[model samples]
Structures are given as structure tokens and as C-alpha cells.
Target: MKGMASYSSSHGRLAMAGNLALFCLILELASVGLAHADELRVGYYSSSCPSVEDVVRNTVTNAVARDPGMPAALIRLHFHDCFVRGCDASVLLDSTPGNPAEKDSPTNNPSLNGFDVIDEAKSTLESQCPQVVSCADIVAFAARESVRIAGGFYYPVPAGRRDGLVSKESEVNQNLPMAFFNVKQLEDNFARKGFSLEDMVTLSGAHTIGDSHCSAFSNRLYNFKNTTNASDPSMDQTYVSDLKSKCPAPGSGQDPTVSLDPVTPRTLDNQYYVNVKSHRGLLSSDQALMNRADTARMVLANINSGSMWLHKFADAMVRMGKIEVLTGTQGQIRKSCRIIN
Candidate 1:
């Protein structure tokens, strides 16, 4: 009987040991999860710039105040990066040791490293935040800032994005929607990434602040017959004539320049819609929205009133942040925001 009691006592002690071990394992897991959550929150908050957008807005407002001739180059840079890959800073990194002149010179057509603005902004943020913010979030913040600087609305930006570790020129060529795409082509491209027709129109509102080179959309202006001219009848004659005067001959790829938004050419207002309403859209894709009965009405409604358009634009941007993003172990934390292997 004593022997039996001894065995039972030993079993009891073993069971108690197992429970304690299980409890300790659970506690350790909880601690790790809490740490991870904290890290994610840090990443999210660092990306937002509560005061940065206002600073950018003031810069653009001051530029216009001083000189209306201030080029929309900065606005163009912001739009180009955001549209291609959901505003990842991959567009700004000069990972390769190429010529610095080639990097900054807008005249260098084949290779344009226009990420100087991105670098400057990142440097500024790093000085203040230091390894807390992600470049992806910074791009979004900068876009709104650029708009505000150009006298546009201050759209709400959602944070919590990480910098991408890869930037493929080939990918940009494939993914970035061209200025010459037809309405259907543009629709398919945006839809592939889960954007609706309304989203497309509102996002294109970005044109309100940027300028495009003749080379970018010369196909539409000069070679209308060779490309999608069926929808060409919808464009504003005055605007098209202006484009023709600038582009003149096909394949010239020279001398033409067009503002995405003619009315508020340098401002980030709802004027792109106003342009479309007046049939003054610069691109076939822009006019295509109005050419269609359904999209045209929506454009008219949104343009006439600013509140709805702003809300939709903000929502679409938030949805964009949730795309097939690379985070955690999927992508590396790129030391340099611009270049990636």
C-alpha cells in the first residue's frame, strides 16, 4: 500500500510539472505576439506625417503666389511613382551606380531617375523619425503634400505600409499604365488591381496637378488614326488643336507638352473633372470616361460637386494600400529606399 501511494505521489508531481511548463509556453507566446503588434503599430504611425502635408501645401501655394510659371515637375514625379506600384519608393531609389547627371536630368529620355524628391523627403523624415517610418507610407504622405503644395485638397491618407525591397524597371514598363491606353484598356488595368470605374476617374483626378511630355502621349495626338481614334471624337477640339500645334508630326516625340488639368493646371483641385465635363481632357483615356454614357454622368456629378469625389479618392487610396503588399518575411527592409536587388 505504501509503495502504491509513492507511485501515485510521483505521478501527481509530474502532472503538476507539465501544467507549469504549458503555462510558461503560453506566456512566452503571448509576450512575442504583443511585441510584434507593437512593432507593427510603430511601422504604421511612423509613415504618417500630420504636419508634412501642410508644409508641402504651403510650398506649392507660395510657388503659385510667387510665380505661376513654376513647373509641375514635382507633381509629375509624385503621380508617376504612386500609380505604377501603389506608391512604393522603388521609383526613387538609384541602386545602380549610374551617372548622377543622368539621374537628375529630365532631358535624358531612355533613363529618368526622378527620385531626387523622394530621397530629399525621406532624408527629412529620417532626421526626425529615424528608422520608424516606411518609404511606402512616405510616398502616400508626399502625394497629398504635393497636392496641397499645388493648392489642392488635403485627402486623408491611411498609414502602416512598409518599404518594398525590389524595384524592377521591367515591372514598371509592364505595370505602369500608358497615357495612350483606350478606355477599356485603362479600365482593365485598374480593375485587375480591384479598382472600379469610379475609382479610376477619381484617381485620374491626380492629373489636376501634373504635366506630361509630348513623348508620353504623342501617339494619341498625332497618330490618332493608327491608334484608338474611334473614341477620339469625344475630345475637346481646342485642346486637341493645342496638342496638335505642339506635336504637329507623328513620331516627332518633341515640342509637345500637355497639362492633365488645364483649368487648375498647377492645382490639385476638381478641375480635371471640369476639363472632362467641357471635353477638354488631354488623353484618350480621360475623354473615354465622358464618352461613355454611364461614366460620363458620374464624372459630371463628381466634378460639379467636390465632396463626393474627395471621399471616393480617399477610399480608393486606402484600398490600394491593402493590395498584394510584401511585408514581414516576404520582402526585406531595404536599407536604401531607392534601389533593390
Candidate 2:
């Protein structure tokens, strides 16, 4: 309890609520019609790898301590992995000869940076519980732990996911939503994965903590559909000016990074809703939430309610983690997260 107090003080207004509130928020998520498959269970590692959670927690904690941005990267890693091959950790594999992996994809290469941390956890797990914990489950658990480390609500991450044997660069674009996608595109993408449109909006809130490259959004700033205005009319003019100063028109030979949430960008919370509502979302895909009345309403709800969005976010994550997961004997538990074993 005292340690949590120390963390709360150090993090400073992340989630902007106490641990008790976060706990209650997660409790409320269960009754909110959120659902996932029965294949994975919270205690999946209770007998096979009892220390799985602790090992991962320690690995992620140490990594974040060294690099505060690691939490966001870990969460992003989870998202990328799940979107492609159902949280099977196919995204973590290195590209082989004539077989480029997901990590090498232009959308992922030079952007994703939490593989070492996952490897560290996998290595420790292999020593203590070899061939027991799967890399897929490790990625899922790391994201859950990252949310807590970044001062968001703690959610239960069901385990039992098996590491996938396949990873392809070609699969990245089809599976992951693009930065230039419209609301309809995003809706269909998450919908095909069995997520409601509201869940799509909720999951987009993960953008609240991470940083994005200028390349991802320069089109919105410089050339939005070849319109007479030369920029997205929906975006706030002041924010556009600020972004232009940092991004420098895209062809200046530099790809500087900007925080996804200018307000408490390092912290995981509902401020992403605040940013989108204010028309300051970094990506067109993110700001597109306001394009539809239905999606906009969910954003407002997330901002107005006290940690209700965070609660719903946990629920969304649970469902997202189960996206076509391979369990039981479906896949092998890779000895190394970077290669099939």
C-alpha cells in the first residue's frame, strides 16, 4: 500500500485518480457486457508457470524505469501482435531469407522498440519454466502490466496463448488499421475482428500514451485530399501550426517524434478523448473519431465519466486479446520470442 502511494506521488495525476478508484473501475467492467472467449483463463499459468506474472512485471518495470516510453511501446507491441495473428507474437519474429516478418514491415520497423524487454522476460521464464509460458501470453501480460505502470487501471490478462509459428510483412497492412483510414475504415477493421464500433473508439484511446512519427500525420498537416485549404478543416488551427513547427513539412530529412497526447502524454488515461474532442489528435485516423455522431458520443462519454473510459478500455483490451488466439496444442511456445522454436 505504501509502495503504491509512492508510485502515485511520482506519477503525478496519471489517470487522475487513486488506486481504489482504478480497482472499482475494473470491477465495473465485468458487468458492462464485455466478453471474451473461454479458451484463455487468468490463472492459466498457475501450475505451468506460476511466476509468469511476477517475472514479466519485474522485466517491464525495470525497462520502464530506464525508459519511460517503454510502457507505450510494450502496449503498442501487444496491439500490433494481436491485430496481425491474434496475439500469437508473430510480430516479434525476425525476418528470414525471402520471408520478411511482421517486425520488418514499414509500419513496424524503426517504430516498434520493446522486443528486448519481451526477450528478457522470455529468457527468465525459459529458465524457470521452460516451454511453459508462451510468447503470445507474455506479450499480452506485458501490455496489461504496462497500463498499470503508466498509471492506468489494472486489468486481468488471461493467459494460455501459444506463440505462433508464422510472421509475414505482407500481413501487417491488411490486419493493422492505417493512420490515414476514415471512420468507416476503422469501424470495418475492428468490426471484422468482432469489435463493436464503440470498442474501436475505446481501443483507440491507447494512443493516449505513446509517441507517433511525423510521417504518420504529415498528410493531414500539409496535403489533406488536395483541398483548397491544404489541411484538414476539422483540426484545430492553433494545433496545426504547432505541429507544423515540429514536423517541418515531412521532406526535411528528419522524422522527429511528438507525444500522442500533449497533455500528460507519458501517462495512460482519458486525455486522449480530450485531445480528439479538442481536434488535436496527432493522426487523421485518430481525429476521425469525431467524423461520426455515434463515435463522437463515445468519446464524450469517456471524457465526462470519471474513469469509466478506463474501465471500458480494460474490457476492450480483454476482448481484443482474444482475437483468434491459438491455444492448447494449436501453436508452439517459442524458446526465443524472436524466432520459432
Candidate 3:
């Protein structure tokens, strides 16, 4: 059998030979496939969804104006969507009577917001272009808009992703990096998505403007070790005292939230790394960056060099938006983002 391949900057100019049997086998084994770099390009919607950028920008801008936290929420929404089902917008699926979707997963549930914003964008697109736009692309675009609105670096988002059909609750935990993940676990989780250690640390900077529920980090604040009444030793005592007030006690309130970077909670800057350097990273996973020599180096470098960090982060986000995307008839563009057609 003969197989053809092409090169593109985003996909690193990959070419395959032989029957292409090996490639298919690998994708099947991993349960995910990389998007053909040529399939998605910077101006993919120039003709199809010409107004996509304006529509998304206006929608996100208005939403952010009403609630400043919306940008961070949109950014995290994109992350959760890509992590679960390969940037297919599966995270937007609503739970049906018999089949609970990713949105209902405990890992996601109340923590992941911005669904209404996405739904609104999809609705506007449908009104203008009908089925021309994909929920997956809207998500990627919204994330870029979110960062730009948050005073962070801006980068182009390649388009042409299609909405995925599957959204199982069970798959969420298997793919997402957990709040309690140790350094190795953190590295492994991102590695599965074809991300590097640097990508993990740089992308983790998104925590700069977001907040976490008390339950996400309550374990670190109380009975951290196996011993009773023990707290995580790596955390600063003063920070722990502040967290304790917000969190109160274990099982007290799961929904009360605290900023990931209390110093600059509303800004997307190097303060997140600065907090990690000070032993003030909110989640165990955030603190875990300091535990590894390699990640620790990245954390400090990001702190000392703001411009470099912003550039690396923008590059990383672009790479992330390409994960296992569907194109050229691989998946469908749903009329409504919350349900499969």
C-alpha cells in the first residue's frame, strides 16, 4: 500500500512511508491521533467562517467586560476540552439521561465554567454561517482571545478542528493532570499529549488568573501526610494560614475558591512562577514543579525572564491547540455545542 504525507510548520513536517500501517497502529494504540498540520492553518476560515475572529472576539470581550474572571475561565475551558478528547469540543457536551458526559465528571463538574460563553459563540456562528464553524475551533479561538484580553501574549490559532462525538465521564480523570499529581505524574500526563516538561510548566502558568476550589487543595492544607493533622511541609506557613481561613477545615466547603496567585490574581504575568518560587503554589501539582530539578529551573527562568516566558507560553499554547484535531471529514460540526447531531 502507498501512503502520502505533507509537511507543515505546526506538525513539524512529518512524513510517513511504507503501508502507513505503522502509523495507524500507533494512533489506535494511543486512542488519539495528531492532526495533519496542513489540515489546519492560521487563516483556515478566511473563506468559510470569515467573521469567526470578529464574532469570537466581540463575544469574549463583552463577557469579560461583565465579569473579568471570564477570560481565565475560557482559557481553562479550552485546556480541559483539549486534554480530554483531543480538542474536539467534547467537554461541551451536556449529560444525557443515560450517558453522563465529561461535564458531569467530578474532575470537571463545578470547576469548569464558560460553557455559556461557548454556547453563545456557537449560536452566533450558527445564525451567520450555519454549520460552517466547528465548536472545536470556537474553543481554540476563545482561548486565544481570553489570553489577549487578560493582558497576555497573543498568537495565531490554527483552525479546521471538528467536534467529537464521544464524551464519557470515565475518560476525564485518565487524561487530565490532577491537582494532587506529583512531579512524575505531572510530567507523564502532559507527555501523553505529546507535550514536553517545559510545556507542562509553561502552560501551568495559566493558573496566574484562575481560582481553585478549596477541595482541590484542601488536602495540602490539612492532614497532608499520612500522619494526623499534618500539612504539606513545602508550603509556607503564612500562606497555609491564609488558605486555612478561606478553606476553614477539611470537608467544610468544597466550592469556596481562592486565587492560584494571590499576589496578582487578575493578571497574567510571571507572578505565578514567583509564587511557586516562594513556596506559595496553591495546588500540590503547582508545588510539585519546585520538587523537580528540571521543572524548578523552568519555574525560576520564567520568573526572571518575563518576555521569554510569554513567548514560550504563546508557542506552547499554539502547539496544544493542535492536539489530535479532526479535519477533512473526520468529525462533524455540531449545530449546538452541547449536543451531538
lDDT ranking, best first = 3, 2, 1
Estimate the TM-score of every prediction. 0.69, 0.87, 0.90
Error of 2 at 298 (Å): 0.9
lDDT at position 236, candidate 1: 64
In angstroms, what RMSD does candidate 1 have relative to the true structure?
12.2
Best by TM-score, which number? 3
Q: What is the lDDT of candidate 3?
A: 0.88
Stretches of candidate 2 off by over 4 Å are 1-36, 227-229
Q: Candidate 2 — number of clashing residue pairs?
A: 1
Report the poorest 10 consecutive residues by lDDT, candidate 2: 29-38
lDDT of each: 0.59, 0.88, 0.88
Q: Every model's Cα RMSD, please?
A: 12.2, 16.4, 8.1
lDDT of 1: 0.59
Backbone clashes (count) for model 1: 4
The collision pairs in model 1 are 57-148, 57-149, 60-149, 93-338
Model 1 earns a TM-score of 0.69
On residues 85-189, what C-alpha lDDT tens digit does candidate 1 reach at each position? Answer: 544555665535442321233332433323455455556656655665566655556555554456445556655556665444545545555666767787888
lDDT of 2 by residue, 305-332 (tens): 7388878888888888887788777879
Clash totals for all candidate models? 4, 1, 0
